[model samples]
Target: MVSDRIRILFNRIAPVYDQLNTWLSLGQHRIWKQMAVKWSGATVGDSCLDVCCGSGDLALLLAEQVGLPGHVTGLDFATAQLAIAAQRAQARYPKPPLTWLEGDALALPFPDNHFDAITMGYGLRNVTDIPGSLKELYRVLKPSAKAAILDFHRPSNAQIRTLQQWYLEAIVVPAAKQFGLTEEYAYIAPSLDRFPTGTEQITLARQAGFATATHYPIAGGTMGVLVVMKG
Candidate 1:
């Protein structure tokens, strides 16, 4: 499946993933990730999971927010990504003890109703089965737990779509090319096209058995966060 291609592309780009993210987002990605974590409703003592935690940006933030009494797990399918995450976690302090695991998003290894909250950034679009991934997310979170999934959105407005395309080509591709990951980064446009819209994400979340779900658009509609709560 083409999902395998996405996995491979991520592996190829893993080394520069964090840097490129900062560059491409004009350093706004960090704030966006924090917003997702905040929307997850995780607290200082809450156990949390960051699924598809590429290079562990969101995971690291979770670690910081959850404090020492909490546990934070950063799970990704790519060892290259997880390795960087592990390295970063080692130097961080006063944060939750972080665990970096190489695992599939579709079939998480955690027990049922295990985590108090969950956050995922820039990963929902690449999943092979969106609904299946949501189901897995639902299965792992405790009752009344919250989750926030942040990702790119295909802007519906023609002007915004044009601007997105221009930025992708002019900024994202050029920056990625500097790291020799142009091919890897080029998949974004197509991926965004295939990604479900904000409204659709809420529909899928509800169908996956979440008690509450809302889609929040951000950055002039080029991105969104799907906030869901398990009942």
Candidate 2:
């Protein structure tokens, strides 16, 4: 039920998702995504997966890292988002080794030890089952493979947390209001409040059976990347 609501919300915002992201993040999202990809440790000709790949930003980044002969599967629950991702790929690469699929994060549809590397951008917070999702990621990753999961986070610093809340309520929500998405964007604050901290995430990752888990705080704790490896 919760997943359905989130899926519908994403589908509704698919058209303006990228544009709003660019505006909201002041174009820093691209750099953050690149950092996630690099941390993913995806190499040339490697099989990669981007879970909850929303419009394919991380997936496209992974595609570039894993060039020809490498395959990238972008999985998202919203068909509209997947459609946009496919369209974007077609325009950018003549024969980009990319495939977009509509799927769920908690139960990824792939074999064990399948992908060389995996990435998820702004996705971990939205998943209904964080630990389960992490387990699925660990299952699909090859031995010694890494998965980089990136998302918004609640800053541990009090001052930064206040600023983040201010930005969300003041700048983000208002801008989203202009696009008739005030409610959609407003959920971010509460979600962040409910999201696990970097330390908690590391604990969860280990519990999910990852061999090693590291949570790197980014953007002054407003963002983070949880890099987990399979044994």
By TM-score, the best candidate is 2
Scored by lDDT, model 2 comes in at 0.94
Output the lDDT of residue 136, model 2: 94
lDDT of each: 0.90, 0.94
lDDT of 1 by residue, 1-231 (tens): 776777788888888888778877889999899999999998898899999998888988887788888889999998888888888877766444798898899999989999999999988899999999999999999999999999998787889989999999888888888888888888888788889999999999999999999999899989999999999
Give per-residue CA lDDT, model 2, range 22-108, as digits (tens): 999999999999999999999999999999999999999999999987999999999999999999999984578999998999889
lDDT of 2 at 204: 99
In candidate 1, stretches whose alpha carbon ends up further than 4 angstroms from where it belongs are none
Ten contiguous residues minimizing lDDT sum, candidate 2: 92-101
Instruction: Evaluate residue 6 in candidate 1 and report its C-alpha lDDT on the 0 to 100 scale.
Output: 78
Clashes in model 1: which pairs? none
Candidate 1: Cα lDDT at 58: 90
